[model samples]
Target: MDDEPEVVEAELVEDDRLPAIAEDRSPAVLLAEEDPDAWLPPEAEEDVQAGIPKDTSRAYKGDMDRFAEWCETVGRRVMPAAPQTVTAYMSYLKRTPREKTGRPYGPNSMDRIIASIRSSHRAAGFEPPDTMGARKVVAGYREQLALAKDPAAQPRKATPADRRVLHQALARLDRTTLVGKRDAALMLLGHALASRGSELAPLDWPGSFTELPEGGFRVRVYRKKRKKWQNVEVLPDPELEMCTVTAVRDLVEALAREGHTSGPLFMRIDQWGYMGVEMTRNGEPIGDPTGRISVNGASDVVSRSIARTGLPGDWRSHSLRRGFVKSARDAGVDIVDIGRHGGWDDQSKALIGYVDEEDSSGERNPLAQIGKAAMKKRGDGGE
Candidate 1:
């Protein structure tokens, strides 16, 4: 995602030089009581009223808000933005300390913030201000920054866990509970499919997860990266206790017993074990899954499953996907096959060396290999 827009891992403190707004002034009161400014024409107003994609809209609004705050700090006009104003904002983003870290925004993040600003300006019917050649400023800074860094002292990436760490996490799940069973299946399928949290979060049962021959199953997912629904197969584990199929089977039957056969595959469960229902407050069939989990919720569930396992503090929903890649590479699976799971582009150097052009076998799907490897390791008595 290029990390899904400048995620602001660093902190930029508010400039103390700026005047402080009164704490008692409510934002709604200020906006409502303020004098009338320029207003949008009907069609433009209608376009704004029409629904927008939630993700991009949030991102754009966030970028604009940050830009406004920065403008206020520097005494610049935000709406009729000048090129010099854009340049100053970009400079601040690059030089300002991020969050608690003294480090400034990274090149990838800086580019996204600039893109967000550009999009907002264009949407407002103005050409992007050409200060520092507008977009070219970011390009110039990236090149200059690249040259400034000592090539050998590259930032260290988070330590990625291997298959054993994953197996240990999976073992910690208490399979006696229905929620536990669902968690087990979720871990396996997420790894097996090499899926993203966005893909895993909104899954609809009886549709997204389909049955296959011989107790195996094929997962159909709509991945944002792929721009369409795609299917990846998960082979049943002969070791009944750990098989993804068995876990899902149990979870499905349990949910169906509560009169749920459709809607989100991963529904939120209350502490008392209450799940989503098709009925409303009046207690009638509503014909849908009553509750849905969020992307962050999906990550939280995975974290809770492994909380006691002591693998690492940073284990996340994406941990399963990374574990799949590491496990596959350790098993000598080709790079080409790895990219095939979610149609990930292989041209990036990140997928190199471990990839084999001619290493085709019965195990074309490396995700399945994760189960096989984890099972083998567990069978070897905590190897």
Candidate 2:
């Protein structure tokens, strides 16, 4: 069934900043911080706004708001902040424990905080402070933290949802049920597209996925980090158990039957296996016209779906994307091709790190090749 067209337009934030700015706070400052168009000249605003994702802009604004509060508290300037003020602020953040973890902020968190400060300064048309000293403090703290073996400083990676795990998880899904159909589609398409939860959450039906004559689908994803739309090609999966195209097609048809022809491709399914709804003031029920699964909600779907199969691993939505990297590498796809498919920047450190980790041992290792040669020599009695 061709679920034909309707188009729609659409952060690693793990830290608690200072308390929210009071409602009585300066409206002008808030407006300027929240909307660049409020302060920036019209000619410069569009380009600057287009460069950053909405989520990022929101995050940077929040960071600046908190910084403004900190400035108020300390009687320091928020915009055109002196290097000393930023340094002091970084020092303050270092000592402050996060509300959830009750632990000091992570190194990456510190870097992001500094970036937000720099961004706020730039947004206000002020030259960014030379944060060399503040950065050094973070660098020193990171080293000391590493030496102490703090888990906070360590990079965490999701366990890749390899073919075995994916097959097992897919087999357990009851495609007959709406919830099951959604889960199956979410996992398969997520892996095929190598998409982030943020990227997948905003996908709209019929518009996002285009049917190719040759087979599979061409998915248009607005990659958040890159701040651009990229077309991703998902090849046809012959394996019935893990066929991404088939799963998506089935889910779309099922949702179409439920009178949900548009809006988010993946949406919340209620407990009774019904699509979600939002009631209006007069008690009229309107189906979730614009609601899409949240990033966390999407991750939970992946985790719960895997859990149903009794797989022993910590899986998250990112596992599907990471798995695509590993799977493609195993299939002898080039690193460059994998990055392009996965929305990773060419020569991305994170992407290269995955490849390096994959090749760290076994036949991919140079030492392993030497060892194999030695084994052959020993078997031939040639020393």
Candidate 3:
């Protein structure tokens, strides 16, 4: 992962061409001079040109293109989008409902779009003033929205009851058939692992998992967030018990039984055990090889399961993680212990934050008899 010294030197030299700013101050102008080809390392360059799966170059390019179009429409250059302009764009998105979907963009989507723009600017070796200050502005906007007294301003959280309904709905899905089995397995594994959509979407059989003894398997995960080496681990849960490891193994085995060993784990199944895509050209399925399941796909699975069983409250993929944490806490597991299992490094702090206020209150409750006896002890009626 080390960048060659020469490459670093060259990049620094190129960066020097940009306007000089005060050493203490962040740059305001983004310079788009460095060639995209030169940005990647030697190994990554190969992966990029070869069109390997999970390469985000296309997505980045798309973001850049969209930003370019936006800049043109606003009569501004990509280097310096004013803070007000950024705010206006966010406001526009909030008011303008999506054309086909009819849903206006939310804070999360707006944040991502701004993030994409910021990332693009940074990649191009330019610093934008608004980019540095956008997060604070967004925070302020959220605060204002929260205090506006609008019903939609306050977002609701998925409750434990809602999760129970979702689980019950998923349980009703018949797993005897291939599609049912696949869906069930996918749902179970996704929930058990608490994996992101992207992590599960690009899974390839035979490549990602190796069978282990004692009804377990070793699974290799490529964590995009880390941008480092792969994580390989043995899942030790019993297959019959529906533990996290078991759930994922069951899904992998289901796909394996159908003779699929070298493609995306979750795919649109067709006859003869062949997987198909929703859209294709020249009969070749266009799998989203970016290792990302569409947000719609994740939402649809959870929502359909909930709808079938008439579940209460909104159920989303994140419910799984929340449920796991809450369930663990209720089961008498220490927060630190639960945090470790959930891959959280700051388990103590997280535990403090996650604990229910009521739970802590019970711990602080004093025994009435003991307190009264202690208070009446020494210099009481006898003295």
Best by TM-score: 2
What candidate 3 gets wrong by more than 4 Å, as runs, is 1-67, 82-84, 87-104, 131-137, 149-167, 202-214, 228-257, 261-267, 270-284, 288-299, 313-316, 347-383
lDDT of 1 by residue, 1-383 (tens): 21122232111111221122345543223433563443345675556534333455565566677887888788786644788888778777766887867777665656656666666554443355665554566666677777888331232232233456657777887777767777777777777777766788778888776677766788887766536677888888776665777777788888888788988777777676777533456766443355766666666776777777865655667666666776687787776788777447767454452233323344755666887999999999966
* Prediction 2 TM-score vs. true: 0.79
Candidate 3 accuracy as TM-score: 0.62
RMSD of candidate 2 to the truth, in angstroms, is: 7.2
TM-score on alpha carbons, each prediction: 0.67, 0.79, 0.62
For TM-score, candidate 1 versus 2, the one ahead is 2
Q: Please give the lDDT score at residue 36 for candidate 3.
A: 36
Question: Which of the numbered candidates is closest to the native, going by highest lDDT?
Answer: 2
Error of 2 at 342 (Å): 2.6
Better of 2 and 3 by lDDT: 2
Comparison by lDDT, 1 against 3, better one? 1
Backbone clash tally (model 3): 3
Candidate RMSDs in order: 11.4, 7.2, 9.0
Please list the residue runs of candidate 2 whose C-alpha ends up more than 4 Å from where it truly belongs after superposition.
1-39, 42-47, 279-288, 309-314, 356-358, 373-383
Ranking by TM-score: 2, 1, 3
lDDT of 3 by residue, 1-383 (tens): 10000101011112222223334432322121334343545565355334422323433344446656666687664554567666666666666777777966555445656765665445444554474455555566667667886444443444332234435765777766666666665666555444445555556666777777765555565443434334444455443434546556566677677666566666665445455435567987564643324544654566566667775655665455455566666677777766655445552453354454555455334565566676687448633
Error of 3 at 52 (Å): 14
